[model samples]
Target: MSDWGVDRGVRVLKGVRHFRHRIRRKMDIMFDAYLNSEGDFPMCDSPVWIFGRSYSVNYDLDELRRSVASCMWVTYRKNFGSVGETSLTSDKGWGCMIRTGQMFMAKALILRHLGIDWHWEPDSRDPSYLKIVSLFADLNSAPFSLHQIAQTGSTLGKPVGTWLGPNTVCQAFKKLLSSGATGLDLTMHIAMDSTLVQSEVKRLCLSHPSINPFASATIPSSSIINTPRIDPKWRPLLLIVPLRLGLSDLNEAYVPGIKAVFEIPQSIGIIGGRPNHALYFIGYAENEVLYLDPHTVQPTVHVGSKLDESEKAADETYHSQKPGRMSFLAMDPSIALCFYCKSEADFDSLCRKLTDRFSVIPLPLFEICERRPQDWTTSDPIFMSSPRSNSSGGRNSPGGFTSIGLPGSSSSNSKTRMGSSSSSTFSGDVDDEEFEILG
Candidate 1:
């Protein structure tokens, strides 16, 4: 008999049916509990309707990392690791570990929820193996490392590997909901940003309908739809830009929108110093949740929570005395991260001259290397092999491999294509989307 026939034939007897029914009922109860619990989370005073989109992997950790990173490596580097930290040679290793692991698990969880097939794996990269090496090192150096636990299945002995962080594991929970189900979307918005200095945020729906990165991939290896996601229909982000005519600090501009004084962290500083008042920002939509900025905002919170009841706590800290940070913007400082600046003086000057003093600078954006004709022939080199660069040229991105020039090459090839090939990359924020900045 076939495997299914043998396994289920007698298994479907009276007792089996009763057990299955019990299991089904238990599952229903569990699902209802989760749905009901979602209500306990906070919501905006005036909620709005918005949609979301995403495109993620559905296979081995390495596979997803390789696939996603292969296209926009600069993004991986920017996101996964520290940036412009000249004090330290920023290695992309940690970033790779965190980002790839997160993507892999997120994809897997989504697929599992969708009842699709997807795989996950441990880190096989060399540096990743260093933790294992540490286990061996500890064995040679410390008594605890040498200690062994006796188990029924033990043959002789076991050298459990020193494991690296489960950036991957953490992502799995974030994607699946410790409770149940896994669904994601790059998230679109018809939202508001009233916290001050914040622009109205919206989703950039560039992924193809089939390339919902938030949604898990149904296939493993490359498929016909393997290219970066794109769509013809444009849904311009509802550009509710405040300061319709002025300039402000990028940090204060896009603070992730956070509500409720209760969810605020208990401490905002350390013993003898200020506790961190800033938090990784997330948002709510029609009762759904959205992950906004995670880091970069702590560039120094320097904000006063008007609703904070901890006046004694505030007086106890030296750091809280700093200038007030614009709080109304979405909480993420990175959201305000733009190279553009038009200082108060510049704006005042412009106002005096009856002109707009917006010294525009491009915000950080994902880069994609569009395969275009290489005009320069020189295999030149720039400062020890052209400074490391993002291949997907964004308006503000540095030159990539092209930055390197033969000993005798023109300056033309050195110019990086920082912008996308298409003017319509963003269906929503198009007309005013020229990567502008003002001080």
Candidate 2:
């Protein structure tokens, strides 16, 4: 044989060896994950709360494990298609915040479709549950996939493969939901400036005439046909309140209020973690926060269009049997509190809880008011009517909706809020001057 041909054959053998090595390394990681235990839950007597429902460590430990395991655990995934135009195929290092955001949103979806009481079983093949899982699959078409979130973040000035802050993730999800990416008929309202205006949320939730409440009752999938049913009543709401509890560390005073958040029935969870790390904070037991960590890296798996054994096996990676805990004081102050209100009554109850419970605290994490403060300067409008606006150009536009960026246009008084030692620092971007001073 020619010398050149022999050299080409040698290169081919080396390439095959490299591929085999990669497969073995991936298998070893998977094996380690299977054997690794996430540590037992705290045996302390403090009542365990997982997304509003409370459980006792002594008796309800089994139920607690089920609840924690049922939560959709999104983590770093590899071998998926490149994110946007970037060549990076894995989010092992920079996608924790995005993964946490996906987890938080997935909880909201669970409440929306499967109901808060729905439980996950290993052999269960409920269509609604499967549909939710598919929406977050690593595929590009998945509405809440990492690819989509990273792409949306890029539009919000966040480059792909970069770590996203809590506020940035919330904003990105809000935009994605507004684009009708998730056909769940839910409205996402991000309470900016640490103030959740009751009127604004009601308007956003109740003003949508195009969304059919009946049609959204069931999960949307390829097999179903939407008849354009319209219900101007109350649409399900995903409320996200981005807060900064302290300048550098979480303030001890706000810890009580944070704990109280889990007691509220509408609570989804909080998206925050230690500096440089992100976690999905689902509940709390006394001083420690119970969370689902997204630090583990797993090879991406696709959930097929149908719920079969292969799809079910692939989804097993989306859940964790063990729940991780962290002390409240160890958390980063910059966080986003998530809630899902399925009905008008739920929203009312949430507001009442905020007013009655959170207000009593010395320093409330946030405030709820019936209307925007009169003295505060008016900011940009939250929603704008599309070209299909109704003849009545009033607040309730039956046509459709589109959302702009943050409410305010200028950052003149942003520093004043952060400069004060007692006040919580707030910023829209991670390392930028665009701060929204909470009232």
Candidate 3:
């Protein structure tokens, strides 16, 4: 907290109060109506993504089919085994259920293009979509272990063979991450990792810190894996895609030669076990849909103040990593995003960079309604023809099972984690009388 006091002229005057102006007018109107320009509504078959001129949109196209950035382009297919292309889970295919089926059909077409209707109970084989159920934390804290059950609510107990509320394995993993296709009993894996800082194990944790104490021996350098447990026999499948990055790129240089850029719209590790440090706006990954394969490598490390003309071996593999510029979120619990460091006396105010329209980051449906979630999924829809729409209605009387699904392979078993659904009636988290439903 001391360095942010002067270095670089009041650091842009205390970075204009955590980037005000209603957070840069909500990331300049959602980055200029879905990746800059074109937001009066009406563009169905939703899915747009063009780079070279910059792009980033997802299903909402209709009425005259406006330009949707020209149309289609998300990538990650490596699977076309039919049934929407493979999934026995040796860590999935067709690029993890068509990129989480265009990220839960673009979060239910941005909650029905912001109009928000359908009074719950949808899934009579996809009525357009709506599964909202959340629990988190178990299997010994498996990837966000339900964010420690929302930071420890109810003090957390039920550890053995868990499964309490409406569970059909979390309603068959929110009905298979909302894309369609299910089959799993137990057998899942995938790998491809990254998160450097070795150089002979940081000179042996700075020459033995009380003989390698812990934080995995001196706060992790970063890592993640399982792109098909490939051949350790198996034991790797972990998904937590919530995304957040920007702790000066993964620590190791606070000032001199400054440099940072960990993008990873999902691909910084392709899927192994040490390369997932790219984060951008808040991140999460314990389950809600995670199918895999998103790499775009090509940076030895240059970043900021002119690192060979702002680096981009091709837009840093779909650039991503933004959580208010990091403070703690990566020790590679099968990583969703990293370089936050938690706190150790605020490593130079958590490695600076929280702005240039990082504008305090937030929004993404208010960061998944402050993650008090019982439902989730979003991101990666540069374009492929607005391919994410499903909203049915029927079980208003059942009230069961929640979310988890992602069985492409690993020996294939048929997804698990337990479920029963029906919880987020929208009463807890962030309070003020709840009722968010967003637009």
lDDT of each: 0.22, 0.72, 0.21
Error of 3 at 354 (Å): 18
Clash totals, every prediction:
40, 0, 115
Q: Pick the candidate with the highest TM-score.
A: 2
Residue lDDT tens for model 1, 66-158:
322211011021211122222222222222222222222223222212212222122222221222222211112211111111110011111
Cα lDDT tens digits for candidate 2, 1-439: 9999999999999999999996785565445333432544778788988788888999998889899889999999999998877898999878998999999988888887777788888777777787788888887778889999888777655678877777667777887788764665788888765677899999888887655433443434642223322233788899998666666556778887988899888999999876667889889887678888899899999766445777777888888877887677667777789999987888998999878887687767876778875555423222432312334432221111112123353332221123244333243322331121210
Residue 249 miss distance in model 1 (angstroms): 5.0
Instruction: After the best TM-score superposition of candidate 3, give how far the Cα of residue 242 lies from its true spot, in angstroms.
Output: 4.6
User: Candidate 1's C-alpha lDDT?
Assistant: 0.22
Query: Which stretches of candidate 2 lie above 4 Å from their native place?
Result: 1-38, 210-232, 305-309, 378-430, 433-439
TM-score ranking from best to worst? 2, 3, 1
Q: lDDT: which is higher, 2 or 3?
A: 2
The candidate 2 region of ten consecutive residues with least summed lDDT is: 395-404
